[model samples]
Target: MADAPRSTPGREITTGERRRKAWANWSGAVRGIADSLLSPATTDELREIVLDDAARARGIGVVGSGHSYADLVAPAGRTLLDLRHHRGIDTVDPAAMTVTVRAGTTMRELNQELAAAGYALPNQSAIDEQTVAGVVATATHGSSPGLGTLSSHVVAARVLTADGRVRTVTRDDPELDGVRVHLGCLGVVLDLTFTVVPGHRLRKVVHRKPLPEVLADLGAFRDVHFGGFWWYPHTSQAIVWEASPTDEPPTPPPARPGALLSLLCNNSWTPRIAGAAHYAAAVAAGRGGARVLRRDDALLHHLPPPVQGTEYSVPFDRAADAIRALVGEVRRGGLRVSAPVDVRFTAADTGWLSPSRQSPTCHIGVTHPVSAHDPQGWIAPLRAADSVLWEFDGRPHWAKVHFRTGRELASRYPEWDRFQELRRTWDPDGVFLGAHLRRLFEH
Candidate 1:
């Protein structure tokens, strides 16, 4: 039976295993102190564990390669079901351009398989270590000229509800829209079937330009460019653009240059303990290179170990004004700018809740270096700018940090009630609801 029938003693796990259970992209702040981390490879087994724990009063939380922040997995004390072992591409329909995959499959693995078949996901969020389920559940996105978030590609999915029932749904199905960005509230999404596009080669062109001139030509540049951006907290400069052709090419060998940089920058102790030794090493490698070029799958994403990120999007027209204001506040506040604020453009999508729902938008992403540094004071200047963004009809990124609450959230998303109706039907018991979710949806 998928649902377990008996109570069993909690499994024992070694400390070495516990250390391995931590997040790959997020900080260790939210890690839970769990007695054991069990990884099941199949749907039936996952169901059995959930049912067994529910019957035994052992709190169980599902984890997908640990890509997100917040205490969703910080069990305080409970059982954790890490889904890494259950990772795989379950099915693919070349004719239909769609694929079905296990929830735990990493984006990196998915792209590799898709490339071999001459296909790839239409859009990908910046980081690639996140599980397919984790990315879709959080409504991850990329800077697509026309499409919406990653959830928009989800045609169907199988979610393990709080009661241990596996419900299969599709975009054409009534409950589809709500569950795609469900925050695991509908339950553990065991598998997802989504659309894929033909693989393509990206031509990267990096040039520094002034923000004002770029904004004046935003529409002209976006017409031909697949991805366009302006870098910040280093606002005096902008990363002009990149264009990629949609065609199949010989697969490239695996590369780790970007991965190594991520490791060095994200280590809290290495910078704190090693100090100038680490900085000296980075300098010795030569910091003069800025042209980031890779294949379609590789160019758009990064694999930084978890650091905090806060992103917000306002109307396209208001983008330049908002950025100038935000930067001004940061400077006036005397805040140290470490990571460059990322600015990207995306056209409106069909998804009702995507940040770019009805109009073209400019996304301003604020990232903090996870390396040891004083960042507590940095949040305040961001908070000040957040106030102005909220006034300009800005919507915060779901996966990133923000100070907005559920009450304000409802005002921004017109489809809020319908989403709530669907959430109520699938998760009537609210078993998957957490503090982060409550603040975002269920006030």
Candidate 2:
């Protein structure tokens, strides 16, 4: 018989011993119990666990920063490979403008290290707390017609396959395209190498305008290096954000009132208070202001309150039409959304599973704070938006909430078959398959 699984380094539990604990994603949207949790500090230790027959007999899944609101990290009676302990800058090649880091390193840590070395990532998502591997796995992105998703920056990666072997993949490797956005199905990513650029500064300008005005001039938004906007539901006003490179000294970001307002909006004391808060916030932001900051600072925005939502990517040309239809549906349904609808853009990328694959895309996100009184009220609006986006051939973001199954998702991704082939080659025994992935791939 195979040896029993080990929960920690240098220690193994008895065959009769089994430990289980409840796990939930960041927003508390998805929760389940994990049979066992393993945090391996080194590649050798990770391989040892992967190779264990007893552990492989059960299921194994990897969990990163747990930022995803979806069930991507939901483990049910399976071992979860937590990579938090395996984090750091492994190597830096300044001449080649590349940095290799352990998969668990957070974007904030990586960006700070790169800044100290006079380098930075070409693009960044709003939140910096996600692990490097997690970001790339989900194809996390930012608003910029010139920059692709984070996965696009990965030139190479070292992944520990289900059979206990490390596979080093480079940009030239055809398999690399699928591995870049593996969705935790391919294998456990050990480390990643990303191409970087010289550190720079950005000037961010925020102003409010009628939604129609901005939508009419979508071309103007795309012309900037980075641009996006926030649309407050039940109102015609929207806050527009545009950024461009600048050499001027950095300025502090304006004080944000979102925190206090979000608290009042989500509080159980009065449900209608949330809608009022959003309106007030939108009105206040309509006033124009500008801030000059380091590229990292400008790219990383404040974390919103605990919320659950979905994001969908549509072709750039159909973005305005989709948004209009979504807004109209929300109004017709009379759904009360407590947060702004976020709109952003990303350049086309080659990642086989990326939402922006093959064409420039616009990402529209709708979020609502968890309500104590009417928790299920937000679902109608999200479903409504999902229907509108789907009509336009929208693809859902991997890390966000969505109800797409393998059959539906396969039709959206042209390289779905190729990704599945690579996944089988790396994890033939389904070692890394989780409940969510099973619904997405095996269904």
Candidate 3:
């Protein structure tokens, strides 16, 4: 489910003329006015705020790097805590192969720092605009059947729970699983310690083929270190992206002149002209050869226009059937999608509420740029696809957009009740379970 999207055009927009208290999410999809905004520089300062009775009643929520499309970060009437400035690497243990970072640090910052230290995460997320906490909270994954979600790599964490305590959670602790991907309902995560891999290079090879053919034999590339595909809607073309660990020396893409202008040509200029040029360029291109990059940059994608995105996971064995059914359903519904359909896969994980829990999974992501003419046009097609994917026991990616409530989702997860029970134990007073979280976890 790791499709990289750059931050929104203008970041989070502030509304409210009087004091500009209202905030819009990265995609401008969710907007609300927080009762107050708080910035805590250090864990002590944050803890002091948590100790104050005021924080509990306000139902505080942390705003990460503004990457999530869901309402998870909308603190409407509640308090919004900004941690953008509260970030930096704390420690790097080369012997233990672990790195400790402040919870507010962005994936970009983390990766740069790790590379400098000769360490790296074994897998790369499509998007690293999110904070470590936000990324782990939603179980953001990478493209590898052998590697699970990024959260699965966290070995330990320090959390400020509802009881006004700074607790250390480790692999030995039962609460660690819940902490791995609880949608920030457990409590405010102060920091995390993750196992790191040695700095390594990955060689990515590109191939183009018909969509139906790729779908029919998706498992052929299953053992590749990292693999995925993008299917252009209404077109028979699909691109297979495969990257594997390479000891060969890195051969990064050549530094070209006017890089910025070239980017603008693809992301901005192409879309404005009906993507005819872009489509022509892509279809006319060959294998596009191969390039090597650090793990952090391996699967990162070029930016697209502001878009609404969502994904669902089906069992690896059932993925082909599920995707075929989804395509047929969308065609029957007469829904039009201009952007390509992104399909990725990940190894099964242990997180209690993880979509891929208990089974290796295939993730299919759909996206469409915001249309001023028809703002909510994507919803109908996604809902229609959901009806079809649900037949294969699809589990929606928590960080993406979806329309399922907890009632409809209870039976899909094995530890659903245990996760809820832990939420109550961690935040019994409901300081963290605001309306958005309540609907997903309670209702």
Candidate 4:
């Protein structure tokens, strides 16, 4: 009965028909096969599917850009809700400096639309491939000590719960924080309203510093307006990126070809992209050049292609020590890795499941892009970093690789018990939660 869903525009989507579908995240880290794939184009249709006895019996799962390194979105055997069709800007109120976007809208599409309308997000994650819903669901963050996680930008949300009621959660609601980063557990989000800012440009400055010097005083760089660093421990050098909001006229397309190749490229050859960028960066190091980029482009940096990585948010004060211990552990475990570790910072926020919850945090991300061709290579390093990160009270990013189960992670998050209570109250029958998510929360 849930198979004949139609789009909000009154046209039936071709993919709405029930069929066997194979699902895999980028980098092929997590994958599964779905028995039925459905794209409900409107909120009413989503509610219908939620209330349908057959659909409820089968269980429901949602997938957006499939970019997560964790097995968070693998909808094996569940009736998967493919959200690509249910995307667009529902409303943009320039006077209020806010935009209402459909849950399935990708950051790339929304960024373009926002720019066209003379506004933009306050900050964005490293890459723009994720859906805005996925960004909020995972508590995606940027490297600005002044900015909170993307979920913090949400002023309101519209979600469909298992009780077959469509609820609009706003700032005044007691459960707003719970809904902010629901991890696809609370319910099916229809759309969200985000607070936006006027369009602006950023000046990105580059500096190459010895890794030891950076480790000596990491706090000095934490206040950089909107920038972070790419650390190459093996080379003992770090590529420092310092970006600040600017009103100056933009610079011409990267003054040098090395800068251009290093910053922008075709996505086909993942490994070569890393090699070429690293070589160019190594050559351009310390020349201390600067370039101006649009706010969206400036927010995004080179995340080595074909990436499968793990990230943890630790107390800002202990981040330097955590990094030292992480590197020591990797060496102790003898895990061979080549991807530069990404270092960034974020302001604290109120989300119950947010990594930076109640703490001004420094995020250390260890990536192994080369392992995209061999996933087995990532496990050793991922496990190696866990103890060091946990010892320093690091909270793992929900959508990246981490080894913490619900019970293991409960003690770390201050609001863990509260989130569990809300999930239990909202989706008692577990219609929106699938097998993978059950393992994450119920275990």
Judged by lDDT, which candidate is best? 2
Cα lDDT tens digits, model 1, 31-109, are 4454346666666776776666552254556666666654455453345667776678988998889999988899888
Tens-digit lDDT track for model 3 on 1-443? 01222211112324454445476677676779776666666666666656556556667788787777778876687666777666989999888899999899998899999999888886767877879988999989988888888888999999888777888999999888888896888888888999999888889887778879998788885787898987755555677888887888888673342443333223312232424533543464324568898877877876555677778888899999987876675556444455667889989889998888989999988765665676776576666666677788889888888888888888899999999898888788888886877887767
Off by over 4 Å in 3: 1-20, 254-281, 284-287
Instruction: Tell me the tens digit of each residue's lDDT in model 4 across 274-372.
Output: 545555555565575888888888878654556677899998998999988866754554543456678998999999999988898989988765344
How many steric overlaps are in each model, in order?
A: 5, 1, 1, 0
What are the per-residue Cα lDDT tens digits for candidate 2 across 1-443?
12455543413222366543567787776778776677776788888878877677767788888889788876777777888777889888988889999999999999999888888889989889999999999999987888889899999999999988899999879988998898988889999999998888889888888889988988776788988998877666688999888898988776765566556434323225555665677767766488897787787767887778889999999998988887787567545555788999999999999999988999999876666566665576577667778888899999988877789999999999999999898899988988788888987
TM-score per candidate, chains pooled: 0.82, 0.93, 0.89, 0.89
Give the runs in model 1 whose Cα sits over 4 Å from its true position. 1-25, 34-36, 53-59, 72-74, 246-295, 301-306, 334-336, 371-378
Which candidate number maximizes TM-score?
2
Give the CA lDDT, 0 to 100, for residue 186 in model 3: 81
Clashing pairs in 1: 25-306, 26-306, 232-340, 232-341, 233-341
For all candidates in order, the CA lDDT equals 0.64, 0.82, 0.76, 0.78
Better of 3 and 4 by lDDT: 4
TM-score of 4: 0.89
- Where does candidate 4 stray beyond 4 Å? 1-20, 252-281, 284-288, 331-333, 370-373
Residue pairs of candidate 2 with colliding backbone atoms? 265-274
Q: Rank the candidates by TM-score, best first.
A: 2, 3, 4, 1
Sorted on lDDT, highest at the top, how do the candidates line up? 2, 4, 3, 1
